[model samples]
Structure formats: structure tokens, C-alpha cells
Target chain A: MAQVVAVTMTVNGVKSTHHPEPRTLLVHYLREKLGLTGTHVGCDTSQCGSCTVHVDGMAIKSCTMFAVQAEGANVTTIEGMGEIGHLHALQTGFWEEHGLQCGFCTPGMIMSSADLLSHNPNPSESEIRHALEGNFCRCTGYHNIVKAVQNAAHSMAQSAMAQAADD
Target chain B: MYTSEFTYHKASSVSDALAQLASNPDAKLLAGGHSLIPTMKLRLASPSALIDVSSLPELRGIRTEGDTIIIGAMTTHRELEFSKVPLLSEVARLIGDPMVRNKGTIGGALAHADPSADYPAAILALNAKIKIQSSSGARVVTADEFFQGMFTTALAPGEMLVEIHVPASVKGAAYEKFAHPASRYAVAGVAVVVHSDGSLRAAVTGAGDHAMRLTKLESEGVSSACKGLVSASDLMGDHFASAEYRAHLVDVMASKALARAK
Candidate 1:
């Protein structure tokens, strides 16, 4: 039998509480308990970054951390980024730039890129590639992924400048 | 894919953690959870309980004290990578990806002492001191005396590593590695530190059972001309690279590190 632990977290702007096995990973908790299926698990090992998410504003591979460790923390999944009609800049950039051929790794790539863009609004192409070293995409060969991140950065900067002008 | 059942304890202080460890001999301290969690999931290490110390204020901070920089044990790799400490920060930037850096702690990496871990070479090269705390009090161990073997250290059963102290007298230092493609671990990594007094220390990792000082190269003054001084047996081989190849890469990496230091 496994020891169960009570965890309370603010996931996707919603407060959630649950009791799960202490061994339950944060990835499994988000997928099984919270029903946020956007976070994919390509490799259970920490090597693959398919399960990337934002923990207190920092990108982390969900499979590497236990759910109990995130108690009282704020978690952001891909679903929190935007709705289907109003997609995030990364989502649209990926769509317009053909960043994915298989789409399995898109959520993680986009989520990891989201954290990157927040930290570096105007990352160079090499910087985008370096920031995405952890999150891999078997499809697309990363050429288009690099283009998509650059596209997003350009648009995000334009919007920021637009907002600043309005302000 | 799943870890064995274990209880979780959130430790508020070092004494509280030590008390818990005394009560449960099989309990392990969890810092950053980057190293321990993965091992736990593989069932390679099944502690009866995990004492979470990632958030302990007592074990988190980076400060300069005179000629030495004192870094709290819980300081994450991301913090170190961005910090002003030259050689240490350079080593931190080469560890894993940003996500891994955000969660991997220097103390946890040092305590685990993976054969390919990056910190050991840097610590040994910089002549850093490790501060360990037990229920009795605190003690310091030199980097050479701290690392005993692969997956082993000088830490007593109940003692907690509290801080790392690095001297600031390095004129220049650099770490160079031939990284394993997938894991980014050093296949043959070398750290070279040139002290302000013109003396040097050299350390190698991922080329042996544990990170070790390359005394021959240090004595020879860490130059491109010292490649022939390294012995073949010091290099390790596996599915990744042959011992001969690793020895070759050691020379290559050491030369690169020396160039960067210069």
C-alpha cells in the first residue's frame, strides 16, 4: 500500500485539492486527477521534456517532480495559455510556421517556449534554439520550430510596443 | 515508472530534519527533487520517507564573505548560473537544460555524486569547501576529502550538507566537456582554475569512477603541452566511448578548458 498525501494547488487559475499517492508525479496528477490532458508524456525519464509546465512561473518537466512537492504552488498547463479562438502567440506561430508535422510535441514545445518568451521577449534565433534544448520535437526537424519562436517573438514585441504606446 | 510507497515529511529547520532522520533511519532528504525523484521512480532508491528541504531558508542563499563566497546548499543551478561567481556559474550554465537548471540544486548534485555530474570538477578545481551540519553541530570538509567515490561522499548518515565555500582568488577558470548527446552529461569534462598567484588546479569528470583532480596536469601547469602526462587507466569506458577514446577526449577537453582559462 502507498502512503497518500493531501495537496492543494492553484492550477490554471483555479484552486484544487486532492489526496493522492505520495509517489504520484505532477504529470500524472495533472493528467489523471485534474483532467488537463494537454501536457503529453513522451518519456517517463527526465530526459524528454514533453511534460513541461510552469511551476510558480518557471518551466519544469512535470515527470521530474512529485505532486506533493507542488502543494500550495501555482501551476500552469498548456490549456491556461488561451482558448481555441484566441490562441497564444506560440500556438498561432506554430500553426502559421508549420512548426509540427506530428503535433504530439507541440504542447510541450509551446509551453516551454511560452516561459522562454516571457523571460526573453526578443530572443535571437540561436537563443530560441538554446532555450528549447530541453523540449524536443522529433517531427519538423526544429527548423520550423525555430522560425515559429522567432515569429512569436516578433509579434509579441510588436504587441508590447503597441500596448506601451496606448498606455 | 512509479516509485515505491514512501511517507513525505516537510522539514522546517535543519534540527527538525535531523530529528526526523534519527527517528526514521531510511529517510532521505529531498532538495530540488531533480536527482532523487528520478532515482525513486526507477525504484533504484526506495527511502522509507523523504524529508523535503528544498524550501528551507536556512539552506538557501548566496553571499560573499571576504575572499570566499558562501553558497547555501539548496541554491539551485539556475541561481548559480546567473550569479556573478565566474567559474562556478560557468559550470552551472553547462549542466542540463533550463528546466533542469531551475530545479537541480548544487548540494543535491554534490551529495548524489554521479560520475558524470559537473559540479565535482568545478568544486575540486576551485578548492571549494563543503559545510556539513549534523545534530551535534557543523563541520567543513575540503572538496578533495568530501568526494569519496561514485554515488558516495564524506557525509555521515544523519548529517546534512549546508553550504559550499569557494575562494575568490582565481585569476581565470573554465570548464570544458565532451557532452553525451542525449543526457548532456560530460563524457570527458575538465575544469581548470588558474589562481591569482599563477599556480593552477585541474580536475576531470566523466572520465573516471568519480571526479578527480589531475595532479599531473596541475604540476605541469595546465598547458597544451601536458596532454601526454595523463594515464590511460584513469579514463572509464562504456557503451558511450572506449577508455582510449575517453582518455583522448580528456586531453582534448583539458586543452579546451586551459584555452578558455587563458
Candidate 2:
């Protein structure tokens, strides 16, 4: 019923090529084809941030984009982030700050927070709240989520300073 | 959510996109895919083919040519948020969210003309112009004439919106909106612009079937107890908001926008 199209994109620092239907969402391409399931789909609609991922270094809802549209993009999923032993700062923050009652929205929260930190390294508490507006955490309120982001920002700043001192 | 299958054509150039449109006739031009893709997923729109114009260099970036600020069709909302382009940047900051802003383009917002979309109010108030291109040639239309009724625009069958031109000297401008909490779409939004000669232009969105100018507010200024902030006849009323409530919002939002305009 659909014509298959060849799409090639860099995923999590790995080059992958796949033939998919023109209508296949990038989220599906990641989950079904690449077997990367960290990015959840709380809502297939664009309203939920669970499917958020970095495309060419910018956070976008993967479900809103077609795999074919990502023709030559460099996408960074949660899998591309730090591994189990060495988690990204946001991931570490979530663990330490009790950020999740249920872990469904954790990947999107981390991905979106990473984008915010990339632009505004030391965001104020309100800025962190505004940045996480797209991401919804129903099981737990945003109190812990905000704390988690602040915790990550604080640690990341400390690490940067330590690295500068080492240099 | 699986969208209906359609042939995808990644256009290499503006002309290439136009040729694809000319050949397919029913093809929809895809820029950013923020608005169009969601619609396709919902089965609200199912075009047989999509000509991807998101990557065309000819339809990207922002520039200033003399007294006018020219914005390419593919300029994403995130770029405009930091562009410092007067009212546009202020309005762009409030659209959808960070992720949606990253992939949503100004041209896509204008072309889709969802009635509740934010930019129509800002563009109309700023007296911006829309540049449209077809296989025939390119033509510019004033923002006032660009948007038609209810999810419609002046764009023709084979044409695509290419650029937007706004006066560089919009000294005083501001936008205020009562947004839907989850989606951040405007429930009642107002944009006000003060021209160099001190003339006023204001427009309203989300309260009506299509965005329209607040001629009374512009003529009398916000200091006045501007009677009839919006026409009762032209408003949209759903379970979320009543026509009476939206009228009240126009007054409240207009005052807020006017106060912020400097």
C-alpha cells in the first residue's frame, strides 16, 4: 500500500541506512529499525515530549518528523547519551534528585534539558521550568523534575570549573 | 501514529520544488513539517505527495535589505526567537514549545493560517508582506490580504510562500496571548505595533474564524475605553471558550499588549 524509500542518517554516532515507508515516523525508525527504545511515546500527538530527540543538535519531537525527512541528519537519541556506568549529568541528576516516580518521561526530560543547558548553561530555576514546559510528567509533579535539572546544572558547572582548573 | 502514505520528493532547489508542484498539482509544499506533518498524522490532510522545500537555500535565513527585514520561508521559530526582529521575536518566543519551535517555520505557520496560529497577529500588526512564488513568477502580497478565511491563504495551486518583509523601524510592538495550557496555542491573542509616524495597527487571533485587525483599538488607542474590542459576529465559540469570554479577552489582552509596547 506504500512505496518504500531509502533513508540514511547518522544515529547516536553510528551511520545507519534503512528502507522505510515514506510515512514512517523518525521515532518508529529509531525504535523498530535501530532497536533503540529509550525514547518513549506517551502521546503520539506532538503535545507530549516523550519522543523528543536531538536532530542536528536541536531538540524536536521525533514523532512529528518522517524518517525520509531526516535524509542526512545527525540524530542523538537517549541511547547516544552516556551509558549505564557513566550517565549524562541530567541522567545523574534524575537519579540523585528522585526526579521520577515512573521512568516513562525520563528520556525526553533528559533530552530536552540537554538542549536547554547547551544554550543556557546556568539557567535560573524559572528558566528550567519554562524549558521543560513541553515535557509532561504525570506520575510525579514537576517539583522533582525542576530540582533534577537544577542539580544537573550545578554539577555540570562544578565539573567545568574543575576541568578548567586542571587545564 | 502513521500518516497516510505519500510520495516524498526532496527538492534540490526552489525551482525544483516548483516543478514538482507543477507536475503533481496536488502536491503540498513541506517546510519544517511541524504543522503539515501533524495534520497528515491526524488524517486532516492527506496529500498524494509532499515536496520537501525545507532544505532549499533559497528559502532559508533572515536578512535586511534597506528599510525592510526580509525573512526566508524556512526560517524556524527558534531562529526568530533570538533574531531580535521586533514583534516577531517576542511572538516567536511564545509559540508551541522549545521542541516545536525548533522544527516549526514562520512560512509554514503563515501558509497553514490555522486562525489560532500566533504569527498572523504579529505580521498583520507589523504590516508585513508575504512573498509567494510559482512556476509563473514571484509576487508579494501585503499581510492584510494574505490570510483568507479558516485555514486558508492567498496561496494558489502551484505557488509557495517564499519570504516575509517587515518594516525595520517598528519602534513599539508587543504581543500578549491567553494560551491553551497543554498545546500553548492562543485562545485569545493580540499584537500591537506603533509606526514611525505614530500611527497604530493592531490585530487579533484565536478568538475568531480568522485573524482580523482590531480597527477600533488602533483608531482610539488602548488608553480609551475601546468599545467593542472585537465584533461579536466574527467570533468562534467552542466548549473551551465562549464568544462572550473571547470578547472579554480581546480587551484584557489589548491592554496588556499596549502597556508592554514601547
Candidate 3:
């Protein structure tokens, strides 16, 4: 008696509907049904943060939520974040600061870091470390990851200031 | 891993959720779904249906009524962490990582009653009360009577927890915990609160099968008397630490929290 439910959500600024099993995790739905594979499933148990995404403007582990639960919510995955040419500041920070090695955890890391920067435009070194407690990166010893987030934070702040000055 | 198939019902109100729960033989109330969904994926639980109570407008606010602060069950940890309630905000900050905090709720955490969970310690120390409702009516239970054992609560089968009530005038309170490196759950945690009358209450979690008040410390009537109050038999331990080590940690964590409260 498998149940299927229809869920409608706004993803990457587009309204969409999905008919998935009630048991289908949001992460699986994003990667399989929508072909949005940028959201990885590092640990199905929700420990690893490779499946992180923004739901209603907050970072959450998509693997832990059912697709049906996200009905009418706004979701943002890595694919929706930025394109290859028009990269998000976090993507560029990782590229410039050597934040990642294998690139497996970059999407989730960037999403979580983006959330931290948005909530706190300026975060200290320890604040960045504390904010990233859920996200695990087995590569680069996390030093470069911290540096990357710091770089992105500064860049985003400066751009906002520049835009204000222009205005 | 994927969870076994189950029907989902999005309830618009508490009465609607209660009706669904009563109709389904093995229905579970879903609030935030952090604890239940993970267990379902592991096949630990197989509910016939899930009654989604996360969207109920009545169960989602923080307000003060007279001398008590009432917190709606669906209120997320992120909301409580930044709320005007000082003791709650302090404890909510240490519940889990940012993402977990974003999705976890106070009522869900209390109902789940994970032995290592952070809320039980603070709730017990603050002498909080839980408000639960059913199709028949609603009733309140004190924190001491609400928690029965690990993953067990006093909530009846058809009942859903709706709010948490705490005294508004806590003179001083603090929480201290030694978080597990991997899961970030507390290995040993203590919450101490000094009431307006100057009597102190202390509760310890993660060192036992369920959160319980440190009666010895309370009997001493002061924070400084908490040292050497915990015995080895008072703690339960696993691969992370031994009973003896946890007993020692209970003392250390309690002392640090007591100092902060003082």
C-alpha cells in the first residue's frame, strides 16, 4: 500500500509540481525526479551535510525530509544557485582559496556557507567554524574551507557596499 | 536509505490532526520530522500514516501569559534560540548544528526524549510543563511527570503535544555539555537554574537512560554543594565513555554550569 502524494514547490525561482512516493526523501526527489544531482547524499543518516539545501530560505538536510513535507515551500539547490559562467560568490571562493579537493562536498558546503553569510554578513573565524559544525569536509583539513567562507563573506559585503555607493 | 511507504495527511488544525490520528490504527504525528523520519528510514518504525502537524497555526508561537512563557510545539529551535526567553535561548543554541536547529522543534525534541537530547535537561531544571491535546480535550503535565524513559513520553496514543510552559522569572540559569565529536549529542550535560526564591534545581542528561534531576545537588540547596554529589552508579555509559568517566563528567559539567548560574 505505497502512497503517492502530489507536492508543489518553488525551486530556483520556478514553480513546479512532483508526484512522488510519500516515503521519497526530498534529496532523492531533487536528484532523481528533477535530475538535480547537484544535491549529493553523503550519509543517508543525516550526519554528513552533503545533502544540504535551502528550504524556505534556511539551510536544511534534504535527506531528512520527505518530499511531501516540502509542499508549497521554496527550495534552492546548487544547480539553482549559480551557473558555470555566472558563479555564486561561494563557488568562486572555493575555486580561489582551494577550499575543496575532490569537489564532492562543495555543493553542500557552499550552500551551508551561503546561509551562514546571509544570516551573519560578517562572521569571525570561530563563528565560521561553529556555523559549519554540521557540514563535514574530509578534504583540505577544513583550513581552506574556513578561508573560503571568509573570502566569500568579505566579497559579498564589499559588493553590497559598492552597490549602495552606486545607488 | 529510504523509508517504508506511508500515507501523509496535512492537518490544518489540531482537531483535524486528532481526528486523523484517531482514525488511523498506527498513525504518528509529524512535527519537524527530524527524529521520526530518520528512524523510519532505518526501518525502526513503520507507521501506517503520518499526520503532519507542522503547519498548524495554533501550534506555532512564543508568548508570555502572566508569569508563564508559553511556547508552541511547532516552534523551531532557530526561533527559540533567538527568542526573548533567556533560559530557553541558552539551551536551544546547543541542541545541534545549525541545520538541525533550523528543522528541530522544542515539542518534537521533548516528545522524542532522546537520552542525549539537550532540551530534557533544561526543561527538567526549569520545571517546565507540557500541554497536550486530543479530540476529547487538552491537559498539562509537569516535566518531571512527562518523561518516562528513553524515547518514551507521557503523551497518550491519540494525543499530540501542543505547547511548553515555563516560568517567566528565572533569576539565573545556565547549560553546559560535553558534545560527542561526531553526532554532536551531549555525552554529559547539566542544566542549573536558580529560582527567584534562591533555591536551585539541577538536572543531568546524556549520563543516564533518561534525564533526571540531580536530587543530591538540589538537597544541598546551593550550587557549590554539587561537587562530589554524583556517584558511578548514577551514570550510564557506552562506547564513547565509561560509567566512571561519565560520573566524573556529570560533576564537572554540573560544577561549571552552577558557577555560571551563580
Candidate 3 error regions (>4 Å) = none
lDDT of 2: 0.91
Alpha-carbon shift of residue A131 in model 1 (angstroms): 1.2
Ranking by DockQ: 3, 2, 1
TM-score of chain A of each: 0.97, 0.97, 0.97
Instruction: Give the residue spans of candidate 1 off by over 4 A.
Output: B222-224
Tens-digit lDDT track for model 2 on B60-80?
A: 999999999999999999999
Please state the CAPRI-style docking class of candidate 2: high
| Candidate 3 structure quality by residue, lDDT tens digits, A1-167 | 56678899888998889799888999999999898999999988877789999999999999999988889999999998889899898989999999999988889899899889888989999999888888888888899999999898889989999999999
For all predicted structures, in order, the TM-scores are 0.98, 0.98, 0.98
TM-score for candidate 3 (chain B): 0.97
Q: Chain A TM-score of model 1 versus the true structure?
A: 0.97
C-alpha RMSD values across all candidates: 1.1, 1.0, 1.1
lDDT of 1 by residue, B38-110 (tens): 8888889999899999999989989989999999999999999889886989999888898999899999999
Q: Best candidate, DockQ-wise? A: 3
- DockQ agreement of candidate 2 with the native complex: 0.88
**Residue B197 miss distance in model 1 (angstroms):** 2.5
